[model samples]
Target: MTTFASSLKKEIARVARKELKDELGALRKASASYRTEIAALKRQVRELQVALRQTSRRADKALHTVAPDAPAESPKRGRRAVFSAERFKAQRERLGLTQKDMAAYLGTSTLSVWKWETGQVTPRARFLPAILGLRTTGKREVLQQLARGAGGATD
Candidate 1:
């Protein structure tokens, strides 16, 4: 009887060891699956963060590309007078442009513009077409004509 009881106890112990090993193997497999899921979630989070950063940068660039508001300077009142030296001076004053700015637009020196305005010298006959072009069609047309070598006098 003692022998049979001892054998029975040994069998029960062996069965319990096998069951524990199987349960441990199942737990390890579940842990590995959870680890893979965590890695995938981390990758997704990183991709989302990168996309968000790109979107924010584009929005910031668009905001910067918009033009700023003009300052509080008032517009000049009354009709523009005729195109003369005095009128040109008044126009320059009203427009708040310097002689250098006008010269730059005319492709000449400020001194030349000053001489024309002061009546010490007249603009060349060729320059009249340019001036008329500037007056009628605007500066862009004058510049285009100058570039195309058709800016000077017809004669």
Candidate 2:
């Protein structure tokens, strides 16, 4: 009778261990899948952070550096008187530009520039801003503008 009872107890213990092994196997598989998904998410986050840093550097460069060929900004005022025939001629001569080059830079005809310099005709109100913009331009910038064909004329 004692031998029968011992064999029955051993059988029950073996069955419980088999049931627990099945449950633990499923749990382990789920844990591994979750770990792989988390690794993918972390990799994506790192790539986005690197891209954001590159974009920030580009924005900073655009904001801080001014181009040498760009014109200076003029202050806004109530109908500022910024153009005169003599001043126009002087600005052209100061940049060592001929009347033809001046006309191209200002996007006008050479005859019109000649007339403006001789004070025979006043330039139209439309040309005032471009004429005024030349006042602060340097000689090197003027030459560069001419070389690039200021009025869209190709060399």
| TM-scores for every candidate against the unseen true structure | 0.38, 0.47
Mind giving the per-residue lDDT tens digits that candidate 1 earns over 72-95? 221134422223455445545554
lDDT of each: 0.62, 0.76
Pairs with backbone N, CA or C atoms under 3 Å apart (clashes), candidate 2: none
Which stretch of 10 consecutive residues in model 1 shows the poorest summed lDDT?
66-75
Model 1 regions lying over 4 Å from their true place: 1-10, 67-155
Worst 10 residues of 2 by lDDT: 64-73
Model 2 agreement with the true structure over 1-155: per-residue lDDT tens digits: 99999999999999999999999999999999999999999999999999999999876544433354554445465534434566678788998989988888888899999988876676776787677777777889878978887642322
